[model samples]
Target chain A: MYLAKIYVTYKPSILDPQGVVIKSALERLDYQGIESVTQGKYFQVQLSGADEAAVAKEVEAFVEALLINHNTETYTYDLTEI
Target chain B: MYLAKIYVTYKPSILDPQGVVIKSALERLDYQGIESVTQGKYFQVQLSGADEAAVAKEVEAFVEALLINHNTETYTYDLTEI
Candidate 1:
């Protein structure tokens, strides 16, 4: 088996409302020394019978095809044998 | 400036309850084709005046000290210049 860790984040120039809300929430909760927050999503996927290169290519395709909106968000992945 | 994208996930041998819950939720919400799901945390940090290596070191320390539990979770990061 293989494990794929994927990260999806907002494009640099785009605004992240979810992040802003979390930052405000943290400040309201009195978390000290916190300046800002930008949030993103992480997904850990388990695959069966796929080699590293195959899995990597599949993951890139998956992200591009469904997981992320390339114009607004970017994604990357790390794969490891299980 | 530098941007740090950190991904934190549950250790391999450990169970991921959040992931399980999300998987169930997705199924309930009529999202198809999800066999399983493992959830994780992602933090996008904007750093000023720090080089990539230094930011990497500081991020490691941050994750070790506060972001992740070494026994239960592991983290990796990607640094980008902006």
Candidate 2:
């Protein structure tokens, strides 16, 4: 089996209001020296396949098709054997 | 400056409905060999501090105080100089 750790984040040009809100909240709570915050989505997926190559291929296809909005976000993944 | 890559995830004992939904959706879409799915929150935080150790200490305190629910979620972070 292979495990894929995927992260999907907004493009650099995209404005992340949630992140802005979080930063403000942290400041309000008296957390100092916080420059910025960016929020993203993380997923861990387990797949059973014949080999690492095949499993990685499947993960890439499924992640692109179902996990993210290609127009606004980009995704990266690390596949590890389990 | 430091970049803290943080991840907040539900405890293993907790049931993740969102993950279940995603797995079902993937199956419906004919994606195979899916064993399980777990969804989590990711954050990239920029902090300015005198040193790595100090920044890490601040991150730990703030993350524990605000980023996660102690009963259901757990968090881990990687701090890197930027």
Candidate 3:
């Protein structure tokens, strides 16, 4: 099987309110030295049979259509046979 | 500076509706070989002054309090000097 680990995050252009909140919370914790915090979505997909290229193509389409908002977020992924 | 990459995922015991939805969509696309799909949250945190160990410790507490639902999810992280 192939395991695809995916990360989907807000584009640098997008404002991340959740990240802001978390940063504020860290400030409250006295955890200094935090420059920025960005939040994102992750997925672990198990595929039964596919070459890396095919899997990558399908994953891109899947992520583009469902996993992320094309206007606001961007994604990247890695796949390993398991 | 330090970069913390964190992943928070659902426990196996819990049902993942979004994952299910994605799997079904993949099926609809005639994208074969997908056995299972699981989804979670990811975070990229930029820290300025703390060493890796101290950052890891504070990150744990931060994630526990705000990032993951401790009862239903689990988390792991990696910190790199940047």
Q: In lDDT terms, which candidate is top?
A: 2
TM-score of 3: 0.92
lDDT of 2 by residue, A1-82 (tens): 8889999999999998889999999999999999999999999999988788889889989999999999999988999989
Compose the digit string of candidate 2's lDDT tens values, residues B20-63.
99999999999999999999999999998878888999999999
What digit string (tens of lDDT, one per residue) describes model 1 on residues A31-76? 4334556778899876664467776776676667656788899877
TM-score for chain A as predicted in candidate 1: 0.90
Models sorted by DockQ, best on top = 2, 3, 1
Name the 10 consecutive residues with the lowest summed lDDT in model 2 chain A. Answer: A48-57
**Docking category of candidate 2:** high
Once all C-alphas are superposed, what RMSD does model 1 give against the true structure?
Answer: 5.9
The true-versus-predicted C-alpha distance at residue A35 of model 2, in Å, is: 1.3
DockQ values for all predictions?
0.27, 0.89, 0.83
Worst 10 residues of 3 chain B by lDDT: B49-58
* Full candidate order by TM-score, most accurate first: 2, 3, 1
